[model samples]
Target: MNKTTLRRRTFLQGIASTALTAASYARVRGANDRLVMALVGSGRRGREVMSAFLKTERIELRAICDVYDVQRGRAKEAFKLAPTEIVALEETLQRKDIDAVLIATPDHLHLAHTLATLKAGKHVYLEKPSSHKFEEGSKLIAAVKQSGKVCQTGTQQRSGAHYRRAKEEYFDKGKLGQVIFARAVWHDFPWQRRKIAPQPKPAGLDWERFLGDAPKVAYDWIRYDSWRYFPDYGGGLLADILTHWADVAQWMMNETRPLNAVATGGIYHLNDGRVNYDTVNAILQYQNWNLTFESSVLPIRNERPGVLFQGTEGTLEITRADYVFTPYKGEPTVVKAEGNLEVAHATSFLDAIKNGTKPSADIETGIAACNPVHLAKAAYWHKKRMRFDETATKMLSD
Candidate 1:
């Protein structure tokens, strides 16, 4: 057997051994109760995923794991689950009963957490900014293939109805015939980038555990909840917000990868000592599409941030909650509302699990859309136009 296949098989064996032996409690009479899940990394985001799963009725959360003792309780309280609490992320992976894990920890922990989970034979719902670096993302992609696990990337916009319709009208329907230029923008006022003062350490919080795999640093109040402002723990605004915007572009462009990227902006306006940018505008090039994504910490935005996919006929505007299609021929916007993206996202994932079909927003999509975020950040972070360096493309040559 090949190395990739062998790795995946070994991962499955490890996970299958951990199946929930506590008690096989059946679900409510007539729902799709095929797979039970265990949640890993119970952060604020992890709890949210758990809450959604609680409503799903399909995924019985068997365990909730986190390095922080404080986090595990919140998840238990949220799901009212008798989860086998795990101190380390790996222990969570060892559970054979957990068919899947939702990883919502800090970015730096993603690589290790995902690698361990996949190798242990579990499907994964990995949160955005999929990996800490381009190389890490590549590695996770290989692990996914080797494990033969279904991965749902947490780019929830993929399930947005407005986005689907916009893509259908613009790209699929070709209503926006031969469109080329697209600009994605996000404007956030200072109140949005606001910070709180440093605080006394809280008990039950495993500071060292949270710092797993990240560069060593003294506790800073800003780094705990606002970890995205730092590079080692998060990719900053580039991977955080830009990935969502790029997903829209990727959807509208029919899964296009940028040929090159140029980024310009700086950490101006926001007074806090944030290492990431406050305003970033980037230009990304595809074979036939030219796209620009703009972000701001001080723009007076009436709506939350999203992307605008411009086409020859119209532009598709999308937010986390909804989307809009505007015909450029002096026409009004065709607004579309996606009732609950979280619901849709979960339902899609559950459906994939049952049918053994690839999810709409799988890891491949995550890798493709997020690679540009890294490339663009590399461009501006170093203040230079960057080119894609193809050293190792993974087993699938993706």
Candidate 2:
């Protein structure tokens, strides 16, 4: 069969599978019902998010999955989980007891893991930068839609009280009138840089499985430990750091789609074997405003990472902890943040599952947040301006 015919058939098959899966798991959960959760990719980041999820009420982590025995063992000890509770991802998904899956795998494996979780009739709490590349986003969107599952993206700021207040008091209420430009900044510390040392791969670590769809190469400890610094496993600063700030900018401005983007950066410092840039400066154009994100690993300044919006009437700068609004004519106002972001985000996910409502950061919002970052990365890689075609979901050279 031709490509189009094959794709159509595959789409139809997916719809049928989703229908069957939904029918088999069609039990409406009430508010008081306990949620059985499974933690996939139980590495450092995975365990951190899992702990936050556990803070929420009426949820139990029934199973944990990780390719590396060491990481899995760490998770088991940290969470006081039984040996019998550990299982492979496929086995964990097969169990009907799991109501949702928390996925914090490498960027490349997110699409596959999330799709599998959804197909198995379980809700998903996927980490940020949902897809490794822009091309994988459409597939994820389709899978989430067809499965009718509540997929919450891990943009914790979306659930932040300070973020909402900043949006409502400034952008939404015209405190920051006619906002024209916004900037997102993240400065990495020295401790974040991974040490480059030649050593044997740790026993029980599945190097090949960790590679996923990335290029096959000899095991490098630095790459394994600092996968975010490499293009194969992650999108460097753009995908790793910028996604959060850009999401905040878009969320507060109420504009998720960007028209075009251009980026320029290089691996200035940290002369490691990593291919992805260490510093990046990207600009994304929207309908009424422009957004820019800049990140650097070099110890240049001690400013906290945040998003700032400059408007005609005033300017608003916001971070996870608080927000400051400085009017052009009047005195400045400050609002301190409240509550734990991770717990709040997890609670939103649980509430969505129980109430059948959308999450604070749903799949579409997640994809939209990543859209500009992807375009900016592509622009940097290709050394050309990239335009996003929202309807076609394609990035084109400008």
Candidate 3:
């Protein structure tokens, strides 16, 4: 680590003890008054998270912040908030009256948004993967300590009943024998296929504002909306989707950090013109066992949909729905499964905000999930079977 990070880390170590006490002591806002929130980035996922936040009875969304004015207007109409339009993210964060901010910005901007929000003393509901860089996540973790903000990650599966049940019933201490391996997969048509091209920036859209922290580039609608396929903006499927699997893997394994990470996958499927592959896979090895997460852009369904936890006593399958408990009692015992977790995920964040507690998917948990994600993606990109760097270990897809 660098001196600045080391110094900040040391300072954060001291603040962690007393910061929550300060948050607890702060004067409570009015019961009738809704917490003022700002939504940064009006992308598809951003809108989804906003919809969840807007569902709450006590939240009065004050402003919608986005670089693209079209998205801002669309979001404003969706949430019915007369958004205080912001192109520059820092300006949006500077509003002292805002109680919290939701960052649905791209991978590269996550760290900036998290740091800025914490510095502004507003709690954050940051989207998945925490950040693009592993070390940057450490910075955000440190910042959270210094700020004492109730930061929540976008890994909403933790709030789902089925996932929670799966963790408790199967992965809990000696519950369903020992969890030997977990396989998570997300497969679907490549996100780049049907996205529209970026039209000319409308009069209200602040192109520069939307490009915050990202490299300067010309406008392309496909690039803006389908940036997940491009290295410059998104982490493709790994950061875009697989982080949810990573979060569950950590939850199931009861682990915060993976001792090693190796990923290997190739672009064998989709012929979309994007640099990112259509298929990607990675394995995160913890102290006791290993978990594998993969995605294929050509087909959305997995060999076994959702996440599969193979244990000694039984095989527990946890997907987007209800989990399946198939006991290996000499003969197979079949249990059907189904799940709808959208509402459950939404409820947890608002509850945490009101109760002054951490949400189910907190920042530390989000960062750890992304560590393997970033490591594995790097490995896949470099085409190495096994590559260990200071940040995270990587293995090529077989």
Candidate achieving the largest lDDT: 2
TM-score of each: 0.84, 0.88, 0.82
When summed lDDT is taken over every stretch of 10 residues in candidate 3, the lowest stretch is: 389-398
Q: After superposing candidate 2, which stretches have Cα over 4 Å from the reference?
A: 1-32, 83-87, 390-392
All predictions: root-mean-square deviation over Cα? Answer: 12.5, 14.8, 14.3
* lDDT over C-alpha atoms for residue 65 of model 3: 79
List residue ranges in candidate 1 displaced over 4 A.
1-34, 79-84, 189-192, 320-322, 328-335, 390-398
lDDT, residue 71, candidate 2: 81
Candidate 3 at 41: error in angstroms? 1.0
Count clashing pairs, candidate 2. 0
- The true-versus-predicted C-alpha distance at residue 211 of model 2, in Å, is 2.0
lDDT (Cα, tens digit) per residue for candidate 2, span 25-123: 654343337788898988788999998987775687888888778888889898876634454678989998889999998898898889889999999
Tens-digit lDDT track of model 3 for 1-398:
99999999999987986787666555244334677888888877888888877666567677777777778878878876686877777788778779988898887788887888889899888888788865687788899889987888878787787677666655775656888898887777544556464477577766666566788988666566677778877787888777888778778887866655666766685555577777777877777778888777775555555788888888877776567777777544344433435555556766777788778888788887787777677667766544344444333333
lDDT tens digits by residue: candidate 1, 93-174: 7767778888888888888888888888888898887877887877888888888888999888887787777677557888
Estimate every model's Cα lDDT from 0 to 1: 0.76, 0.86, 0.74
Candidate 3 contains a number of clashing pairs equal to 13
